[model samples]
Target: MPVIALLLLDGVPGPHVTTPGVCFGTAARCHPRVAYEVRLCAAPGFRSAGGPGAFGVTTPWGLDGLDTLAEGDTVVVAGHSGHPDGPPPGVVAALRSATARGCRIGAVGAGTFTLAATGLLDGRRASTAPGLAAELARRHPAVDVAPDGAVVVDGPFHTATGVLGGVDLFLRLITLDHGDAVAVETERQMFLELYEPGPDQGVRADAPLPGDALGPTLGWLEARLDRPLTLDDLAGHAGLTVRGLSRRFRAETGLPPLQYLLRARIQRAQRLLERGDEPVARIAARTGLGTPANLRHHFQRYTGTTPSVYRAAFRSLVTSLTPPREVPPPGPGGPPAR
Candidate 1:
């Protein structure tokens, strides 16, 4: 239930004029119950993005800047920060003071440049929208920028890919604080399909994949998890080369062909574990994991537990149950330590 301060840096485009405002507003709606106390602040003498008649803004701290920033609070700067060469005098002073007081600061999109100017991003993995990725690295030698990600959370800082992908970043922060069950529902309730968390890239909905045939093949693969389909078979089915299939799968699902197939098997195993009490070997064979040992190899690698243990751990929801530890040890000599 900690409070967060989402400081709207001076000279940013009004939310009504940009997507950041839309994303933040929608996030507030979705997680109404989470204890997030968000406050918006503008430096002294700030007005709307358009010169003349901007909405009148006032703050407790006169244009003194960062004076209003509280220590140990989370600060989020949004939209384009009018200064790219470096942070404005007021912005720079405030960022330094806030960091000196141990505050966590972040920016959405180009705002990252401002954070970079503060030197807090030095040696940190931060990101901005795709276009600005190179500029951020070039301008600030200390920051380690990700080439393709909608958001990057390095240590205390949380950054976004700008106006369109800020919500994903915000919700990711929320998930780190709250949980994914809430994060998933929040995305489902408020965002476009592009905002989904699986892909760090904020790919637009209109973009095309490797080829038109890859789409149907992806859907076909998703629908037929019960079948033993290999990477070669998938490539053949899509009329794509193996390399082409790998690239397209990475583009579409943000995972390689074999990795995606492994996930599909795990997901299938999870469903079977939850719905029925079948032997691990049976579930493995049915889901194309081949054997219980193979299933445990991937299962433990991904979920940190074996199939029966996972089943027992999850099955406690519906009936008077036994915890995983009491389920009698895993079968003999089968990947002994798993």
Candidate 2:
């Protein structure tokens, strides 16, 4: 199994220490063939802080454990509470050494600061907790900071923002390692919506759809996915002019109004396709794509695969893993009693 070593610094947040294990562990359980040996490596006697209580976390490996990692392995720098303080020299040196050996590196939350300190993120687009983006940019001027991205991947370096950002980051990593099938199954088992970023977005996934001024409009659009909606309709629903709506919508959802609507429609079509054997034409109509040809065009553009192929791949993976449900025999006059 490939190793996913989570490098823990002192005062690391509790979730930062545990989320990787949960994510990769769940992925392994969901797809037995795709597994990772998750290791929590820290300096001697490092304990976590910033939750309701502090506790001793006994990690099996020390910083030197990073030396054992190879090209296919990964080292994730977990977030610490006192993030303003730079990481220790030993940790920085170990990370630099690991980079030299071609190990993929990632950082979660404030740990982006730690990775940035090593100059590995220099000239790379990285993300951190939204509130800390300015400080990260100020401290490491060479590192391009994308404050709004939930997860940002630049070459072999990956960075994620916020408390739940690790989940997104690890899922993305799993997708890269295994395939979308495994990652989608893992998401289903974990009850998480897979947040695949667009190609032009610099490998950046946006945070959850906002519940701000556009919330009502978004909800309305979702309810009426079967209807033809224009920019004017969305702007009118949101009580803004077309230009204002376009600007604000892009600012909030990271896509222009019509583009966001198209994405939403495609996503709904994806779910409908995965859940049942809905004919492509019906699925397209239900999602307001008008015709099967239009659906195929946009779906291919966004997902890089035709709708039927996507459905077949997803269903085949799911069906292979799931056992058939057993049904009780019927009685003479009626179905068997509960």
RMSD each, Å: 20.4, 18.3
- Lowest lDDT sum, 10 consecutive residues, model 1, at 200-209
Residues 1-338 of candidate 2: C-alpha lDDT, one tens digit per residue? 89999998888877777788878887776443566999989854476555645676888899978989999999999888766878875988899998888999999989999999999999999999878999999999999999685689998898998455387789989989977756765665454333333444211121133446677788888889899899999888889999999998777666787887887787788889889888999999999999999999988887777888888877776676454666867769986678
* Model 1, C-alpha of 303: deviation from truth (Å): 32
TM-score of each: 0.49, 0.58
CA-lDDT, candidates in order: 0.64, 0.80
Check candidate 1 and list the clashing pairs.
44-63, 109-162
Top lDDT model:
2
Write the residue-wise lDDT of candidate 1 on 233-277 in tens digits: 999988899999988877665667777677667767866887887
Poorest stretch of ten by lDDT in candidate 2: 200-209
Q: Which residue pairs overlap in candidate 2's backbone? A: none
